[model samples]
Target: MNWVRGDSLGHGTFATVNIVVPANGSTFFPSPAAVKSSLSHNAGLLENEKEILSRLGSSPHIINCLGHDHTIENGVEFYNVFLEQAAGGSLADQVKKHGGSLPESFVRRCTRSIVEGLRHIHEHGFVHCDVKLQNVLVFDNGKVKIADFGLAKEKGEKHGKCECRGTPLFMSPESVNDNEYEPPADIWALGCAVVEMATGKPAWDIRDGSSIWSLLVRIGVGEELPKIPEDLSEEGKDFLGKCFVKDPTKRWSAEMLLKHPFIKVDSISFDKVHEPLSPPSPSTHFDFPHWASTVTASLPSSPYSDEWPGWSCTPESRLRRLVTDKRPENWSELDGWMRVR
Candidate 1:
């Protein structure tokens, strides 16, 4: 597929993301899709991400990887992977836009989507080593999808001695101490993400000038768990309780959480109670400045061409249509609640 790279969306330590337009006007690919590129010598992680997404197949709750290719620019070789663009930006951007905390209903909706994505990843025998708000991309329709699988690994994949992946702020207890990365670790990180969404703060109280060592010790060396948001609903708190369990064996799996009361609530009505003050606006244009990358880097603003064709149907809309068409005869057991089976 021939494409031209556009504006710099964001850059992490290993990869740079930019909006790319399909030069051939291929209907097979989304126009202005995101392309993550890295120097050829440093493309292993990008290649792994593409392979992982390919293995996982297409899911509405997971970012779609269209394809990958090599390109040369300025006498340098680069590897690039095309991904579905989430115009609403990352969940972190939403939190920041809302002044730190998100409405509980919105948090519930996003959490449900993340869990669904994690369920798919875990059932396929893979672990998302880094599950955080920054890694969850929000769509214009308010649906969320799990993104950034660069740190993902096969279930039970072993790490080298004293090695650990993922940001320290979101690491599971076992991962911090024993170098273990598994499905349970993802759940733990999900708990942290929930806390961030509900409270607009890191799960741990890392005051100014705190060292990473201290944070690791707090997570792995003690019985302390991240504080749950007091303002969160009872079901929400209980749901997080299941995630914050220190014992991986006892932690709730994604399937189990899907049955939890927190996720089973009537999102349509519940959403009305605490509607977002500033819901993300639907747009076909790319808005990349607010999308935070895995690593922090100062980025320059660039304009995207408006002449590109729009998608016939977005992934979120397609998924909604599919659910409406294939919904079980008895999917809802009560008003405002969905049955899990």
Candidate 2:
């Protein structure tokens, strides 16, 4: 693809992201895109990410890959992949701007979008081993998508017994212990991400301390789980409880979590086709706050069946309502999560 490289977007461990524009002035993308590229000598990770994005195809909740090409500067070849620009930046940046914690309603909506993306990834038989707030990109329209799949792998794939692939703060019990993981592990990380989104802090107390060993021991060996924010709604707490299960086998799957009440609250009227929100002005960049409850309150309730997945907590109350009706016989007693068959 012919493009003119622009300013640096951000720097990663193996790649430098930059803004890129089409050289021919064709309207391929309405706005400039972010290109992630690295020297050919260190292209393995970037190439793997490009291949994974290609395989995933077009997904509403996953970052879009415009295309890829290569360039040679100073006799060194560099591989570049163009991605849809997220003008609003990352969830981490947003969280920081919001003074470290986003509102519960915004967290619910953002988490719902990420869950949709995870469902797509798992359905395609891939596991996004790194599912954290930093990797979630946001658009001006208040939409979020999952990005950065360099460490992703196929389901059931094995890794070096001692090798760990994601941020320690969001690592799953299995990953901290055996270096073995799957899609369920991503859900565990998702739980941690939700806590960070809700509380503006890491899920564990050791995050600010200098004890990686203590943190790993607490995650892998101890029966302790990350603390859920008390300020969250009942559905939000219950949702994290499902994702934070000690046993990967019992943890909620992305597909199942999509059915949980927290996400369902966001799904109430989101399926309808709505035009994307206008991009926020680049000059007036904001870090990380979310739309208020009034925006969500304006959405119409969907016409779903009474037996719909996690509808027990529904009265169109926007995720804060209690489960007044008897739970379907299949709900789990341990954490109040709906056990999807």
Candidate 3:
């Protein structure tokens, strides 16, 4: 709690964030921190954020809450919370620096990290009512962590109109309709964040200056989902499909998504160790159209059972499938693309 305030990081409607250094050689924390504070009259929001961060405990993906304190200036009291300072700044800052969009590879890596953080939050029985790129912070090591918990609530907590939370641009369908939302709502916001990362634009086009009410109407009642980037790979499209499901119960959970094909990283060997090489003096290349019919001409359309044949009904089983698949050479020879694991 003993600290000296430094430069301002940013200012919000309710609070101002400033850099903090330990006071009088205090060793409470070695690293610098960002302190969020407001005058006594407007301290409730910042105080609530401090409480939520404390309850969530420490995780590499969640911002660390070192402590809190109070100070008096001109006879006015101010309350503050000491938060881990993200050296690389907010995710929004990164997008801006990258010219309003990031490469697909960078988007995938960042999305994986955010999903891991969301999984931890949901497992801990809390909902991050606000999940947007602005609230995600990037560290020096390129690691991203979720921050700004002033609107977070426990699972299944009813949200009345007076307590409606989060930014309109990222609000889920349920949130837009009735202000009733849950952990799945956060997933919807996460999907929006991914689109922003890929296109360097808000998930929905807001530049035309449309009314908020009209935008929410489209989200809550429209048949179509936000447009997915055409340039994305099939696996990437499928990953987003899982996020944009209209039914919250059907939407993919963070735990399930951690096993998805798009985000999983691994190395696969494409060459067969013992394959005999033929002379390559001629210009003719290998064509499998006529040769492929030999193996599949007589096979049933649906060869396998309803469930995946080799994978058992377990989370770990699904996650380990690609890593354990031994036919890497065959996979490489096919038309489909392969990612690093």
Candidate 4:
């Protein structure tokens, strides 16, 4: 029973919960009822998570957004979200404990799974602005899932551009620049994930996560991005390089990276190009940081590169002009309106 305890779980910047309640679905009863607290009161705030999750059912690699409720307790209003619980904990927590990144093969598999989740979301017409290891929950089953749709948006909705919705280390160069962003933006974050898994630590998670205003100012002016590790293999470095591009157009598509030698997926038959040298496990070993060892990488040209207007002031950053089947590679073309349930 993972119950929501108002006394402990109900207070956050975007949401307010006085307690946590038991998740009604599972009866194992290890903790309180699970309640996913919202960061905002407007139902629209959680609409993106609602939209993306509604389209995706149960998958081992994706987090489950079960249900939600807008209620009042002691005259205080709050939105209670019922979601799948991950006891093993978030990827960030694990990376911090492990000291630095995972093996290349391990990163490849995990990155593939996360990209799969992003592929599903992008297939529908939504953009997950904030993609990071912290939002990914690793379960005891060795599965990975993307969580936290707090910063997602529809194709062309007119919301403000979020110059910095995610953690600094995991943020894309475009995010730091406050540029007009789109699906590729998530790809950029995915690149950072590659680094995180490769090194076990986010390049800049230690920096200003709280100074939004100052951070935005720095990002828009091209504050130098922290270097990723340098010891990574050519394949590992090349793959992440494509994802870190400042221009959304240049960012590698999930389809493209799936073919990279450094990426591994169990879906491939054992005889594929080359089997993963050895399966990634707790016993994997490395000589040194595989990626960015303090080597600062400059960003590429931006197609829509412009100063970020900030999420609160950006135009058409929402779902207004976006049609279901606008871009062939976009999400609306894959699944229709039924995905929002």
Candidate models: Cα lDDT each: 0.71, 0.69, 0.65, 0.52
lDDT string, candidate 2, 75-161, tens digits: 657888889888777887777667777777678788889999999999998988778776888886677899877667788888655
Estimate candidate 2's alpha-carbon lDDT, on a 0 to 1 scale. Answer: 0.69
Model 4, C-alpha of 115: deviation from truth (Å)? 1.0
lDDT of 1 at 121: 98
The order of the candidates by TM-score, greatest first, is: 1, 2, 3, 4
Q: Candidates 3 and 4: which is better by TM-score?
A: 3
Candidate 1, overall lDDT? Answer: 0.71
Backbone N/Cα/C clashes per model = 0, 3, 3, 59
lDDT of 3: 0.65
**How are the candidates ranked when ordered by lDDT, highest leading?**
1, 2, 3, 4
Candidate 4 per-residue lDDT over residues 227-262, each given as its tens digit = 567878887787777776656777788767777666
Each candidate's TM vs. the true structure?
Answer: 0.79, 0.77, 0.76, 0.64
Candidate with the larger TM-score of 1 and 3: 1
Q: What is the lDDT of residue 332 in candidate 4?
A: 17
Candidate closest to the true structure, highest TM-score: 1
Task: Quote model 4's TM-score.
Answer: 0.64
Clashing pairs in 3: 100-200, 266-340, 266-341
**Which stretches of candidate 4 lie above 4 Å from their native place?**
1-11, 16-33, 38-44, 56-58, 161-165, 176-178, 204-226, 266-341
Better of 1 and 2 by TM-score: 1
lDDT of 3 by residue, 97-159 (tens): 666776777777778878888999999899887787777887766677898777777898874
Root-mean-square deviation of each candidate, in angstroms?
Answer: 15.2, 18.2, 22.2, 13.2
